[model samples]
Target: MRIALFNDYRIGSVNGSRVADITEVVDTRWHGTPYVINEFIAHWDQINPSISAAMDRADTHELAGVRLLPPVPRPGQILAAPANYRAHVSEMTGSRHRPANAQALLSPREVGFFVKSPGSVSGPSDAIELPPIPGRSFHHEVELGVVIGKPARGISRERAREHIFGYLVLLDMTMRTDGEHQEERTMRKSFETFTPIGPFLVTADEIADPTALRLRLWVNDELRQDADTADLIVGVDELIERASAVVTLQPGDIYATGTPDGVGPVEAGDTVRAGIDGLGEMSIPVTERGW
Candidate 1:
């Protein structure tokens, strides 16, 4: 099922040209659960049956023509895996560098991860604000966002697929700056309005294979990043497993699996659109904001 948050945070299911009001279903008994974005994830099975039944009995309502919100507007945490793409890692650390030294140069870890404050998230088609900081380079990284369904830890790559809930497209907006120390790499990358995810949540079951999807991004109508998830250096299952080893993967938690090459910048007034083949697309306008 394609789950979405729409019309002033109302919980609904999407149908062709229409959005059914299941807000009543949640209101009748699941009031404490809140939006479909929140409960459909945290208690997937709990509401799955009710959601399915609601879809069957839904009364058609004129499409609200409402906008979509990041599938999870307030994910507990947003874990971003940086440079997980082979070519991206090479571009950051010259290709001549060794893996061990590359890890040191990046500083976070061999994998180099960062946390984007949940408040930084905005939906696709939303506006992106450029912070007032001068000389800081801001770049866009389009990535595949993995949504967790079940809680997991110390998971094996082979078993990672079992814990996944769904997938969404994400833009990991980055702010670049040299760290305090000469050899350090603590850049303030996780900035507000820096994470753009969703248009909708494409349930995992709807997709046959995650790695086979085509991912692309365009800025102001010009293609900037074009690639396939098949080209990923470390695939989805491995990433979930690797991350589970370090931290428990809880329902509603998200992992941005990194972006492909063609990293670039966008200034105020630019429109950035990105998407995956089966998943949906998101177009966001760029605007300037004061620090």
Candidate 2:
């Protein structure tokens, strides 16, 4: 099932061209703040049956009528893998914008993972706002966002699939820092409106093999990034096992499996669209901060 959160966090189960309103059947306690989707994911074994039943009798809305929010809004931890793709590793390593004082770039297995502030997440329809800081260029990293369902710590890669809830399209917008006062690595990617995710979260059951899926991104009308997940240096399951060792992976926790090569700067008035097979696609506008 494609689970989605629409306007005001109303939950729904998506069908082709329509959504069945399942929010009424959802437990009211998970309605606001901290980890609303946690209960929905952690209890999915119990909730899935109810949601299916509810969808049969619930009101349906045209998919285009409602605004789609991030499938896991306000996730507990927004973990992002840096340089998970060998092509991206080489691209950034050779880029003119590569930080002068930065350390050597390597695959995620060696570098570990970094966190993007959960506050940076926004819906598919929202605009990507560039901050007022001058002389910084914002680059787009289109990636696969993995949502965890069950809690697990120190689990093996073989057990990783059991903990997964779903997957979604995510754009990790990065601000390239320059000048004498450089922005920290985490800070550079944690700016508000930097993480745009969704359209819908395609449940793990819908996809038989995550690594076989392909990801593609476009700026305006031109294609930028196009790669297959088969090329990932640190695949999804291993990422979970590695990351879980450091921090207990909780329900609704998201791990951005990192982007492939072709990341470049975006400017105001440009539109960004990204798609992953099975998980769906999202297009968001880019604009100067209106503050």
Candidate 3:
């Protein structure tokens, strides 16, 4: 089922252009925090039955009419892969997008998974605000986001899929750093609204093969990033295994499987759109400074 968190943190099951409210079926108390999404996912097997039974009788609304929030409102951690795509690595190694006087690029095999501040995350419809950093080139990177459904540490690649809850379209917006003052990637990527995710989360059961999905991104209606997850230097299972070894993976934790090539800068007033097959898409506007 396509699960979404819409206006006022109401949980819904999305069907086509409409959504049916399933919030009542959930048994967990939100405690006044949208972190309820985490509990909902963690107990999905137990909670899904009630939600399914209620779908037919629940109140429905147009999907476009409701304001959407990040599927995982406050993830415990936002672990991401860097240079995980073969083309992305090669491009940064030699392409003009490479930072000036930078060392040769490294792949995930060498660098491993990195963490970004969870505060960087925002809803799909939220405008991406650029932090005040003069002479900075902010780039857009569209990637597949893997939401963890269960806790796992030292998880094996063979058992990786078992812990996954779903997938979403995640844009890893970045601020390019020069060689003179090389900055940490996490800091460069952790700015507010830097990680805009979710049109809705497509449950893992609905996706046959995550690697087979195609990802596409457009800036102001012009296509820029286009590729398949097949090109990832490390696939989903391995990413889970590798990441779990470093830190405990919990429900609502997101693993941003790095982006494919064609990354470029975005300035104020530009709108960015990205989508993945099977999963949904989102459009967010870019602005300078904070809200």
lDDT of 2 at 229: 92
How much lDDT does each candidate structure score? 0.75, 0.88, 0.88
What is the per-residue lDDT of model 1 for residues 94-170, given as tens digits with 9 covering 90 to 100?
Answer: 43222333344332236546677878888865788888776565677899999998897999988887888999999
TM-scores for every candidate against the unseen true structure: 0.87, 0.96, 0.95
- Residue lDDT tens for model 2, 177-271: 55545678789998889999998988999999999999999999799999999999999999999999999989999999999999999999999
lDDT of 2: 0.88
- State, as a TM-score between 0 and 1, how close model 3 is to the true structure: 0.95
User: Candidate 3: where is the Cα deviation over 4 Å?
Assistant: 95-103
Error of 2 at 189 (Å): 0.6
Error of 3 at 33 (Å): 2.4
Query: Per-residue CA lDDT of candidate 3, range 1-291, in tens?
Result: 898898888888999899998887665478336877887898888887787688878999998899899988899989999888878877778655456677666766787888889999998879999988865789999999999999989989999999999999999989885445657878989999999999898899999999999999999999999999999889999999988888899999999999998998899999999999999889999998754
| Predicted model with the maximum TM-score | 2
TM-score between candidate 2 and the true structure: 0.96
Residue 142 of candidate 3: its Cα lDDT? 98
Ranking by lDDT: 3, 2, 1
